[model samples]
Target: MSMWIRIDDGVATLALTPPADRAVFRTALIEARGAMLSWDVASGQRFPDAEIHSPLEASAWLAEIYGEEIAAAVRAAAATSLPVPGSAELVDAAHRLAWLMWASDWWPAGVYTPALNGPILAAETAVAAHAVEHLLDDEDAVERTLHQAVDAPSALAAVPLRLRADAAALLDVLTGLADDHGIALSAATVSTSSADWALAAGARGQIREGIEIGHGLAPVRWADVPAQTVAADSDARWSLRHIDGVPHLHVSVAAVPVAAVPSTEAPGTEAPGAEAELWARFGPESLDIDIPLQGDSVGFTGNMQVAASIALLPLEERTLWIRDPLLAAVPGPAESEDDRDAVRAQASIRLDDPDASLAERAAAE
Candidate 1:
């Protein structure tokens, strides 16, 4: 129940009531790190939960109470092997702590860039691994087991159901990050909450060639799939590239997509197809819009201003398609202008169809 940091002599020691719950205990460790880093050592002052002690006493107490993992960190600090911070270092570390806390909330909601998400999740996994290793007391053995679990996630299936579930969720999130950014992934998982919400947010999974999302697995390509596409306007630029043999259109937004004008497809008239099923899942508030991006008027041979315009709808109303160039293009935050255009251009679904080959069109052009 109590968590605090004590600095005896020149050695800093972290103490906390280790929660039996793995998730809670892991968070407690993170909090402890932040607390220890912020403790003021000057003026013989200590924080509400902070303590100061001699090097020998602190190590012995930590080793007895928290086990070897934390004790190792403490001993390392005592030996000056660990990077001990001065006042300036404490300030910088505090800033990092604040950013991570804020990021922890936003990343789960798909509010970060592909470039940033992978590193954040990777660091989190490492921290969790350290905590697990300490609690298990096996050091190298336990750490190896965790890495093994990454390759064989089901290896944790034999663990307690709750522990297994947590492990799975962790692996799923990490895998999602790796898959999205075209990074090599071995054994890892992502949170089930994010996966479930992704599906509910109009995303789909291509299981056979993809990573786990929840009870099911989705293709890594889903990370590139945007809820909808938008073309900025007349000045919008476009580019093309191929990933894993799939060519994608990259667009610069000259004019952004507009909101849907309400669907003409009335309820109970006819059965909705796949796209309709996608919208129906969001209830009745969703609207459907299908607008085309015609060629630019400025120069006859200028790049086309292609926009799908579905992203302008509510997130639930919007449907994500695997074939959309946007789905294969890495996503930026909802507010990123230039990056958003690039993402929209990558989402170009027009040339995605095999029936309408790009080479044939190029020949005609």
Candidate 2:
């Protein structure tokens, strides 16, 4: 495959002709971008721009980063004017493998997106590493390099039993790739067998079951509320409940679908009295709570639980005013018993008493 490089406005771009080579080149470029270059801020330039211009120069640079085997392949391809001797599937799989590696570092764990369990992450990384190795015939080179960085398993193990179906599906993909490439995946088979036996023997215990908060809460319009403090499609709810012989008031506001509301203020300008109004609204005894944009929605829940006296207010006084009553994401035709249970479960958690019964927490705020 032919490699082309272009530079404009201090940005560098590399392009490879033909789709298959382009995929492989993109993957390698992702690998190189992080480690291969250093910036000279004083000179406003990057060092060693020379090795990136032609295929021969690129191969020499690749040798320093990815070792001689990959570099030799690139050199051979450039000389013969032919694409690399790897299938499109291998390139695609390798790209995905690289992404999973990056996800291990940069995934934003939150309420909707739960933190990656350590063993599960390790097992997934191990599977992806093995698949890349088989696809590239690299003899565990990728796996070994990854192990040096993180505690990536040499062989997949400790996969939770609940995730066996998912693991099997991943292995099935690897198996198909192996079949297409005419390679035997003995390591993967052995690893799978061991994991299955361990699961059957209860060697690795089950993943901890936690109550999924906000399970049935629907997105409501911001304009529905009198204050309009939250963004559109925000999940907002308030309730008063008795918990463990004590009353509690629970209020929650979650920016659903999107984590944060975009700022409406113009550049280099602050809205007049906005900061003062925000402070007043979020101050003590106020019904509104400041839900930080960066944090999970659960951060805004149960803010008024300490001011339980609000629960003693008359139903008319405590009523949540809605400007447009029907402006909500409608649930199914009828709420099922399970839906009711989920709502009760969520309400109990928000009321700051996990053991409270549904009947005790019936009233809405």
- TM-score per candidate, chains pooled: 0.20, 0.28
Model 1 lDDT tens row, 73-119: 55555422222222321323333332233223222112122111223
Alpha-carbon deviation at 86 in model 2, angstroms? 7.4
For residue 353, give model 1's deviation from the true position in Å.
Answer: 39
All models, RMSD in angstroms: 21.2, 20.3
Q: Tell me the deviation in Å of residue 150 in model 1.
A: 2.0
Q: What's the lDDT for all of these models?
A: 0.28, 0.32
- Full-model lDDT, candidate 2: 0.32
Q: What tens digits encode model 2's per-residue C-alpha lDDT throughout 149-178?
A: 232121222233444454456545545544
Q: Best by TM-score, which number? A: 2
Pairs of colliding residues, candidate 2: none
Cα-based lDDT at residue 132, candidate 2: 48
